[model samples]
Target: MRKISYNQYQFKVLLYDVPKKIFILLFLFIFTLILLYINLEKSEQIAKKHERLKVSESTLFIDNILDMKKDDIPKNSIFFLDTTRMKSPNKVRDLTLRQACSIESAAVTNENVKVFIVLVSPYKTLDQVKYTPAMEAILSYKNVHVNSMNLLQFSADALYDNFVANGNLLKSRFVKQHTSDFVRMLILIKYGGTYIDTDMIVRKKLKDLPSNFICRDHGFLNAAIIRLQNNLGKKVGKLFIDDLIRNFNGSEWGWNGPLMLTRVLTDLCQTSNVNEMINCNGFHVLNEDICYPINGLEWNQLFNEQHASKVLQSVEHSYFVHFWNKLSQHEKIACNSSAAYAQLARKFCPKTFSLCHEYF
Candidate 1:
């Protein structure tokens, strides 16, 4: 090869370094872009995300040591609730104080939601659900009291919507032993907010209970989680009452409330398609889990062993808890269920099961 001059050597070295410099620059630029994309994704979703609140064993430990007392309800917030008795002859597991603690521990997990309990009872038996000191203290939320007018107000509606004065007159009668439940939710319209059942405690703060629509445990919506716009909710309630009364002859639709509400609101989809009706189902949707059978084929209500397993498998996550029906399942796995659930409960609330006594 011909000998190269010094100037050419210097130029060659500079040329050689150029590609290396470009490659380094390119790698750094790409890495920076990836990081930017990640931050952007998180920032965009921050509003919808739960803001990452935690409820762990540490909270439970502190709770056990601290003698937490019920602070006086400073606000005179009117909760138009029908009262419910704590223990019924039908209930299988004794809903003891330990259960309350378990429920309380479950509740504290959610920072976004404040539980609201609506109680409906006979005018005379109001005290049954009202003065349970353990419950009152453990419930770090609001409670509402209402009258069920009659025992049949909640369950007899579908049967009597046509025959009786109200839409669910007869069905309401059957379920109305806890009438405040159905009726007091109307107050959510005028009162403006969410209705959290006493039976349901927070396992976590659900950032989106699918806010655009009310959610059901099943694929469809249920009434247990009623989300109504202030004035709109009141009107829906009034219409339900009036329609029930007008159809005094009774509706054979049976006592399925969430379904009936969906039926009642079917008119809203007049111009829209059937799918549109489904989209708007949230307006009158109920908590499908409570409304439908847990083990059934209802896709939204698919909760149980399978549901929990799937959740554990997924890192991004979906669904939580192995909720048991107080009235439905008994002579079964009440004390002993999932080891994960048992351990989780024990880890978070050691006294919950421990505090359980055969009081009821």
Candidate 2:
């Protein structure tokens, strides 16, 4: 073979090397394009999911409003307030399993009495709301109606309109609690029906209870469960609202809630005895056994497996069970736990309970 010149050798190396480099660069370019395409696809999917969620939420909001408008508030209406604001569709709403249990229990026990869940969001519109699995399950009940209420608007029309105007709600340390206290009274005044706390699990029909009544807890009368029949012009609810506004204290927690009820009832009934106060001053003061079978101090008994049976037995004659959510919110109730609350939910709110894969 003839010896190749350095120039020829260099030219030969360049010819092969150039093609290899070009091929490698082309491969990298293709890979980068593929990666970019994949990222774009993923981004599109996420964006579409968000958009669909928005549309679904909007439809649900509109449907809730329309449903409320179409369904007239009946004489035997029981109202529950979803006072917590939902941050996003991704964020779990207030309609948790426990809260839904209350709605479900009320709806099931009082089939004739329309159960109205007033979704109250002062800042955000209903279009921004999202329902959890628990809410959906309870909504399936024929007696249950999910509705929207603007806090400001409702307060404006309430007897204690000045309470909202004075910015007392904003000044309260416990805004949600204070707002709920005010809103429930407003609901009773306007609708002239029962206003039950979202934490209560009703085992009996509230429609059968006295037209104007409030349940007792240990020492104080709780606003957890209240009923008022609308009398022409002067409603019993007006009394509660007026008293609530008159004695409204923003600093103390229960000052605007159970304490407020106790104060009002004490003045109206003219006695501290809850039993004697029954049918006193045109309203009944229900015994603790009726709604608060398990007191807040004994709230753990409902969650403790050892006390479940005893707790259940105790509440046999009770109308409903108040789990004292504020005290037990951090306490987990396993789906298969033999606790009283779990058992109650399993029986009364089966659909909501079933949705809990592990714990509620």
Candidate 3:
């Protein structure tokens, strides 16, 4: 046999063995690309499905709003607006126990008055939205009606009807606060009914209050509770709405809210004194204690076990109890605690109180 050189032997091995190794490597690379392509395709499909589901939910919500009839909502209704924008069923936009307490107390005290909880979300329907135990408790009342309304649609006419369309409200640093201030005024102008803030707990029947009135809070008229009625051919609600729109300023926080009410009442009554405003025909200004028994400076007293009795006793003669939620929202009131808020919730909004497992 002829002996081969080392170089020729290596050349033969490279030609024979390298082809098999390269073929295997090429096959693996192609397989990995195929697997990656399949996974990417599945991910795209799932994303499309999720998008479609969201569209379906939003469409249903819009349909529900369109189905609502004007007659379904009573003229003497009490309106509470929920301005949260809900995104999904898993992310339910239900009321907190404290907020539900406000509604429950109102429904319990004003059994004869229709209570309308207007949801200002355009993407979630009442039927599709999940209800918390607190929300269900309030909804058990026959007078309570949970309805959906598109904020943009409802504000369309109001925005175009006045000089407020200048986008001052949209430019505010506190957009939600300003929007709420404007919406409450628009609701009063359009419906002529009572508008109560979600932070208030009703202590007495609001239906029996003056036809058109607002409560005073620390020298300024508060819009927290407003009962406006068109009577004696005087469109007092409209006048306020017009004035608010004409003098719209989004720079200051409460300028469009409590402060605006003060200015408007002064203009309407042609006097700066609260007593004179109360004497104004077809309009009244209630005393501060009637609604805000505890000032914002002492709002924590409502949640103090030691001061519970004192706080309760002070508000005994009051028609409403404004807890200054803005100042006390982060302060938790323990369930069944001796805090004044707990006691009041237990007595006035028992259902909401009972549903709370821990701190409210």
Candidate 4:
């Protein structure tokens, strides 16, 4: 190479350094953009994300407790619920109303009995759960406790395999219904409490009924409203767990729910007929009028204005009115309306009716 002047050599070095300088600047710029994007993403979703809240008598967490033994539950516990599966706006509204109605009914009928509503995952605040209105309404009551229990807690450790297997099948299909079906039994078994579906309008204090009992609906044993006693309740609950692990039929709807209850009770009692509440082994079976006065197929009767008077009469005599969320979640029970559901909502769950008027 030809020898160059000092000025030219200096210029050449500067040229090389200029690109390096530019590359460093460019890299920093891109990194800054990335960080900005990430923060923005989190900020935008914070509204929908779970927030940490205090744990109290009325608000608690069953988080990370894999082996929730039966004794872990309280003796005075008589109510349990689930609303972790529903996600849609309409469904959320229904849950809010359902929860409101449930809390109101419990407060009115059985102020002494505590009602616990379980959430799917952990969250700090009800606002982060996407059903803030309903959650707040439920929490507003003195007897209602809103809590979060990890799905794994229900069947973690050695039972992990069975829990994940059955849960996976349910998650892909009926996330809300089947999961509710499976977990409700576990909750009842663990706590020996009454499991009431959110869709139903509670008609009376749950403790007024037998301590250990299940109801019949449409000539089939229904798990919608069930009260599990201590020893026998634990036995039936164990059977439910075993059936779910060994013979869980995710393909057939209600296999883990009503149908499973019918099969287990029949075998446990060694009885052929489970259509009516039979005083089997230790638990009693109640007639359909106890929890499901209206069959699932004719759930519309509650929302039909013409059936308003009749539905009112029937629900008055029933323990709870099952609205069948699958069929009636989208149906509006407008406030100050003539619909049977509206009438019931106003009379039983006034806050829920107000929310329906405000949100729906």
User: Against the true structure, what is each candidate's TM-score?
Assistant: 0.49, 0.78, 0.76, 0.72
Poorest stretch of ten by lDDT in candidate 1: 59-68
Query: In order, what lDDT does every prediction score?
Result: 0.40, 0.75, 0.74, 0.66
lDDT of 1 by residue, 199-296 (tens): 33234444445432344454444444454544455566655545434442223423345455555666654422223454543353434332333422
Which lDDT tens digits does candidate 3 get at residues 192-254? 688899999998987667878887777677888888767621377666766667777778888
Candidate 3 colliding pairs? none
- By the TM-score metric, which is better: model 1 or model 4? 4
The TM-score obtained by model 3 is 0.76
Ranking of all candidate structures by their lDDT, best first = 2, 3, 4, 1
- Each model's backbone clash number: 53, 0, 0, 5
| Residue 138 in model 1: lDDT | 46
- Full-model lDDT, candidate 3: 0.74
**What is the RMSD, in Å, between candidate 2 and the native fold over all Cα?**
12.9
Candidate No. with top lDDT: 2
For model 3, what is the error of residue 187's alpha carbon versus the real structure, in angstroms, after optimal superposition?
1.4
How many backbone clashes can be found in candidate 2?
0
Residue pairs clashing, model 4 = 51-124, 51-125, 52-124, 53-124, 277-285
